[model samples]
Structures are given as structure tokens and as C-alpha cells.
Target: MKFTGSIMITCVKATELIEKRQIQSLTLGERFKLRLHNSMCVACRAYQRQSKTIEKAISRWMHITNNTTHHLSQEKKDKIIEELKKL
Candidate 1:
């Protein structure tokens, strides 16, 4: 379905979109709308960037932890915890 230009997605829905890239491959029309909406909506843009950062961090953590059954190195674990603390 085509998005009507009149309505912007809600914050929760925009977050979902950020996490899933649900509309990353937007049609040209949708892309234009998103750009306009994001430019005007600081909250939505912040939510999107924060959520995307979380998604990437989770992926990286998974990759690091999945490499072996052995416990994660203490240094690595401490670094991760430190970074999370900053968040």
C-alpha cells in the first residue's frame, strides 16, 4: 500500500522500522516523505539513530560471543560492560 503524504509514522512504528529496516528500501515517494519527516522530527530521528546503534551493537556482541563455547575473555567482557555503561 502507498503511504499518504499527510500522515507520518508514529515513534513506536518508526522504531520498528529502524530495527527491522522495514522500509529501508522505500519507494521514491516514501523516501521523500521519510526524509521530510525525519528532518522535522528530532525525536523520531534520535530514536531511529539510537535504535540502529543498539541493533548494530547487539549484532556485534552476538558475533563475538558466538565464536566459541569458551567464556568470553575478561578484557572483552569489561570493555563491553564499560561501553554499555556509557549508554
Candidate 2:
């Protein structure tokens, strides 16, 4: 879907497009619209930058959490079991 230079999108639509682009590929029209909007709108550009930062942080957190391992020591496990039995 090619858009002529005449079409204009609102900031809300542009931000939604930014988010959608994160999850999936966007059509050329959508990409063009977003870039055009971002170039003209300061708030939308800031929002897009913030969104990208948040996505990067979340991805880093997920990677760290997935790779790390946690374990309870035998003493702690035994104590917890004994306490449960008393209850």
C-alpha cells in the first residue's frame, strides 16, 4: 500500500505504529507514515525513543532471569519442611 505524500497520520496513530513495529513487520505505508509523523512531531519522537529504551531493558531483564539459577540449601529446605510439619 503506497501512500502519496498527501496523507497525514495523528500522533496516536504514529505511536501505535511504533509499538506494532516492535512486535511485527510494518507495511511500507505504515513505516512511511510513522517516519513522517516522527519527523514532524517532537512528542511522538520522544515516545518512540522511550518505548525503544523500555523494550531493551525488558529484553535484558528477561535474558538475565532466564539464564540465572537459584537453589535452596539442604539446611534451609529441611528447616522449612520441619516448620510446615509443626503447622
Candidate 3:
């Protein structure tokens, strides 16, 4: 996890760490590397934001779908399926 001239982890590694962070807490080193990388990499910063947004949206969706008392109409379910498939 050396910053070197590139400032830190590669974009690929940054993306992986970003996703991994959603599943578990990152190590101190991992978080430091990710923060450094994001600070210098515009694309990676955007990716992090997008990844967080997607995770939050999915979490909300899961909560809604898992509520047995709040049933979705078949038509609404179908629409949801169609929209998800597009993604």
C-alpha cells in the first residue's frame, strides 16, 4: 500500500476496496489507501459515490421487499423486475 508517485492504490484496487467496504469494515491501511486514491482520482471518487448510492438503494429495496405486511401488486412487481433487468 505504497503511494509512490501515483499517490496510492490503483483504480482497480480502489474499486475493489470500495465494494469490500460495503460488506465489512476496512483495515486502517486499506482506508488510508482508498482515501488517498480517491482524493487524486476523479473517476474513482465518482465510482465510490455511485457505489454507495447503489448499496443504499439496494438496502432500502430489500427492506421494502422483505416486509411481508407490505405486499407489492403484481403489476408493480413486474415493473420493478423490468427496471432492475435494465440495470
Sort by TM-score, top down from the best: 2, 3, 1
Candidate 3 — worst ten consecutive residues by lDDT sum?
1-10
Clash pairs, candidate 1, are: none
Instruction: Encode model 2's per-residue lDDT on 1-75: one tens digit a residue.
Output: 657655599887899999999899998888888888888999998998899899899988877745446677899
The residue pairs that clash in candidate 2, if any, are: none
Per-residue alpha-carbon lDDT of candidate 3 for residues 1-87, written as tens digits (9 for 90 to 100): 453345367999999999999799988788888888888999998998899899899988977746457676999999999999999
Question: Residue 7, candidate 3: how far off, in angstroms?
Answer: 7.1
Q: In candidate 3, which residue ranges exceed 4 Å CA deviation?
A: 1-7, 56-87
Candidate 1 TM-score versus the reference: 0.51
Clash pairs for candidate 3: none
Task: Assess every candidate by TM-score.
Answer: 0.51, 0.60, 0.55
User: Could you give me the TM-score of model 2 versus the true structure?
Assistant: 0.60
Please report, in order, the local distance difference test score of every candidate based on alpha carbons: 0.70, 0.87, 0.86
> Deviation in angstroms for 41 in model 2?
0.5
Model 2: residues with Cα > 4 Å off, grouped in runs:
1-6, 60-87
